[model samples]
Target chain A: MTITVDRKIYSDKCISNAIYWLSEKYIIERKLDGDIETISVNDDNGENFRTEFLRRLNDFKLREIIETETKDIKTILYAKAFGDFEE
Target chain B: MKKYALLPFNFTQIDGKDVLINELGDMIIAEEGTAQKIVNRTLNDEELYKTLVAKFFISEQLLPPLIDIYAARLRMKKGFMDDKTALHIFVLTLRCNQNCTYCQATSREENAAKCSMSIDDMVNAVKLMFKSPSKHLTMEFQGGEPSLEYELIKTGITKAEEINVAEKRKITYVLCTNCRNLSDELLQLCLKYNVQISTSLDGPDFIHNQNRGKADSYQKTIAGIAKARKILGNDAVAALMTTSELSLNYPKEIVDEYIKQGFNGMFLRALNPYGLASENENWQKYNDRFIAFYKTALDYIIELNKHGTFFREEYATIILRKILTPYTTGFVDLQSPAGIVNSVLIYNYDGYVYASDESRMLAEKGNFTFRLGKISDKYEDIVSGKKVRKISEIWSNEVLAGCSNCVVRVYCGADPVRNHSTQGDMYGFRPTSFFCKKIRQ
Candidate 1:
């Protein structure tokens, strides 16, 4: 699951959507965000990826903060959960 | 106005690419749902007005959707050229002694036996370079090691002088080297030829030696900088560099070393995710760590700058230049691929000519390929051929998705080579690429 969250709206939105599309094919966990906030996900895999993604993905430019945000998150999480859009 | 006649679009399948493989087995990754998504969303639009939208996107033509035909005609005007800029890369030599891991130069101890360019070849290449719409030329050199073949250094100046004398064309020269073999002779040549020296220093001794390879790597490079500074004077020996695994932890150390060595600033570069290094597992550190590395280093440099530290960041300078200046060189990486072409060309040791050294580096490692002309052949055939036009289309064409909608498109340049490496296309949606994201930060 990839969670790409960049304020670079148009282009990144497309990438964000693509991650969702991939979700239909695999057990993917994805999310995109505006500003990165430390979230405590109750799911086991959720915390696993969050640690990796946050550790690697911040490049200061909003444009770059999303790609690694996708990959590192994908490696551990379950299901495609996008945005901070809560349950 | 149909360009297909001049240069046809050959939609070959990307080779061996599970998504789209062509005849030669080159890979091209294309998603399944994109075309359908486009079709589904736009199928029910009010009317067939895409031609108007297409014109708007490419030419900034009248806002066809905003009003009726009368208003559009009033708004229509002569279109501005939105093509990629000219880049003139002057390759000084294809000879290098060291065997670094990601050396796309294909240089080594064995390659040293080969001869570099004759003065005549250089003179012709320079003259041919000036034939583009680019008025200003960025004369950058790379090697084997540029210093190995010293005569070409003098010849580059002599040729530039000859052309500059007649055409009065402005040409800026940059020499890329390791500075290991840096000598008084080379420094003198640079001073004489008016070439600014750009060299690499990965980090401090142990790490740099591990990355650059060679026992004397640190001592020799530092010593060479001393000699380079003597001739070029202060700030003449520019530190243009690469980032590797060893360098990730040592950004502060790298900055400190650069200052100690008299480099006024630095470009805390990221390693290219390609070449010999591409296959190696050791070089692949977490991208997050890279971000962290940059954060620490950049903070340090910024602090240095805020306190009136004379240091400036070259990459930051390039970004700032694009942001602050009306005219940007836009080298596609840092350059606007859609602006005027600068008059620099890369002639590899084996006689292949590419638009830039980075292009050759990408091609040699097997992707984003373009050959302008072989030195053995006339420039007419290569430059006029379909491949050159194909590449030029990839560079200047405004039809790409990221580039089209990108507000930063004005400031950010696209590297087809980098894109091809990651996404297997000349125009990968850069705003979406991991490498672009890392660098854009």
Candidate 2:
């Protein structure tokens, strides 16, 4: 699914801090050790737009970016660690 | 005026394709307890701006000379590793009846020239263990399956008991076994030796048998646990660990399995990617998923406690202790991937000993340098060896950019050996590290 990330995900204490927030918005999952993963957003005939975890933010630089951003997305981070990866 | 709070801070940086922690030092200008309260409290927009600006100014403002004094002073007061040597794990044997995918130690092949410890080797190792100033010396026996050499253990305990009495030292004996071979005879002997049982039972029958395929491992283990409790008569027997494929699917079922077996506690363990058997398993760890799993499972256990189930998740308990208390028993799990740890020494099936059981497994692939000393060698060789000291130091500092600023750095631990084995790099510097991903959560 095409999802957008706020630059705040890169602020200091931002990467891990995003764990609590992001999980609420997307599913949290991992593949082997250093690989980045993303998934397709799905909907039954009516579910519309909601899906499991979008994808793991792969770049370490991206992780740092998520950690360094100062903005707080208190919108309870979405996450659903359910289902298999959609390739 | 530019000022940086000598408060604890971790500075993470991304370079090239990896992340490196430029710095990590928590200096509390305030007294001890004060730092814990404000730590990890995610800074707000204004606060974040101020912190970054202050750090930037300090980099540009302070002369290098003053920062050095401040850094050194913080290290002295907070001395991260309190007891130089806290736990002494001796691999009694490496023979197993089960085929677990995450068995970090190699199985003791019956034809692989297996040799049980002699009375002398046990006595020497026990004597060496007492040399450290740690008041309570805990000697834990681990293995591919330690119970295989019951004779050596019984004799070794007699010697350790003799030495501890002679030296006026206190020691606790712990055994990490598979319980499949736990017999009535073994239980009686374990009781006689005052050895607390630490066995493994990963989930229920289907999931457990698939990961650890011993013909009657389930029934034998359940019966063994019953016998162990009958012999010990109380909360004496405990479960050891192993993570598996089935565990990933049903975190709750695993917890229920532990509860059903009436395990004293269940350690949600990590799969060692390295090992003779596990190398080809290609198991993956989901950091974010595991974190959620940990929290959910632990919170479930807590809920069970309210219903009078009285259960504890070992991983969460240890982490909670680190967060809630001062100075833990120094379980290696709590130390950061960058933290230093004089490893648990592994005395293989034969007379040879290595820095850790994992080291011995590496030898199968022709990496022979793992042998730190012989069971017949001086105890000083293992404890004070240059190689052990050097390798241990590699993890003692925060080298990962993400962990540098991790407020939870003190609570998380890094495994250099795992990173080195899996990534082919002794030092992994990103939060993406399997070790970091799990521990940080």
Candidate 3:
């Protein structure tokens, strides 16, 4: 199974995470060429590797969106927790 | 779209409803597409809007007026930090009578040589335990069978009691045993010291016996429970169940068995990857099956509750306590700061301190990544050592990659030991984590 994921849409970290998770069930090999990353799977379990990979990829993208949105608020929250605001 | 700032919240779809969980473990379940609307800033439902605003899910103003209150409540949820290492586990020995197949501790035969904690080690461990400034401490004895070592149990308790006279800390004692060897002397000691008994009962006779690899295991365990309850009162004895592969097919049977044994609650614990149990090659399948089994058992328990049985699934209760209530749970496994050395510590039979029970189990397999220090080491040096300091880095869900943006991070915990054991790293990759999958479900 071969699936090409675009780096512009999904970050390399997200793709790496998806591959790491899927690597448990499928023997996955990745090739990166500029903005495109191709993942090859050797799945003997007859599982739909492409579907699972895409689903997790989308999930990671959603997480990235949430992380990007909440980054500042999280920073402020932690700053208030461990920082000396009075000084 | 109104310019409403986002508070720290995550959203997930469950039962066709969009569930929004905030940083303080507050949650709101809305109709489907609610999360899409929330992310798109198109939410128009007045009641939902009010809920989002009130629960610190969203801020209408530049900053929510309750930012300070939110931070304070968040701090309060982690109040276990103020009470450092309340649960102290004392591994008495690795020797046991019965040979359980799925035993996580990898118990040895009754006469296993040199696996027991020495008196010097126990005395030093007890002294080290008092170094923690926690006003309330619980000394829990664990083993292949702690009942076999009645002397160590007595010695540890007596030492704690002797120290308490001067230190004036409230202390509680717990004995985790298989219940097959709860002798009269052991029961008498338990009675004198007010030691609570925690025994394992997987299910009915067939399942329990099969798991224990003994024909009379269930019968003897039941007899032991009866004896302990009679001697120490029913309230002093508690039972926990570990879900094995075979137990997955009999969820209702397991719940019914607990109820029949007069237990009002059962902790539907998953099989941890350690010891002989880790030798099982089908962890992914086991995890999936266990999740299904947990839901089935929980449903049966709830049905029993509806029928006036008052039975509760303890793991769900801990998660629910975080989700539905404002208070934090004392459950070490499901706490932030990883709960290894923060809320619990283990003094093993080999005179070494471990981060948690699972940490000690890793040591049983010759991996000492989570070994804190020797029992003789100073408490400050052990907890604040170089290794512990490194572990502390990834102990918070607030900072981890996948955990940070998780809608359920508030309800979940950071487990560095589990991460290190399962993923070969302290900072776990949540995408592939079975722990994350089970908890999210």
Best by lDDT: 3
Query: Which has the greatest TM-score?
Result: 3
The parts of candidate 1 lying over 4 Å away from their true place are A1-87, B1-87, B118-120, B282-286, B324-332, B338-344, B366-368, B376-381, B396-398, B429-432, B439-441
lDDT of 2 at B317: 79
What residue runs in model 2 are displaced by over 4 Å at the alpha carbon? A1-87, B1-6, B10-80, B109-112, B118-120, B285-296, B305-308, B336-343, B399-402
| Ten contiguous residues minimizing lDDT sum, candidate 3 chain B | B1-10
Rank order (by DockQ, best first):
3, 2, 1
lDDT of 3 at B297: 84
iRMS of each prediction in angstroms? 19.5, 15.9, 2.6
True-vs-predicted CA distance for residue B267, candidate 2, Å: 1.4
> What is the descending lDDT order?
3, 2, 1
> Which of the two, 1 or 3, has more TM-score?
3
- Put down candidate 2 lDDT per residue, B121-206, tens digits, no spaces: 77667766776566666778877677777776776677778877767766788888777677677777778868888877877887
Model 3 spans > 4 angstroms off? A1-70, A79-87, B1-3
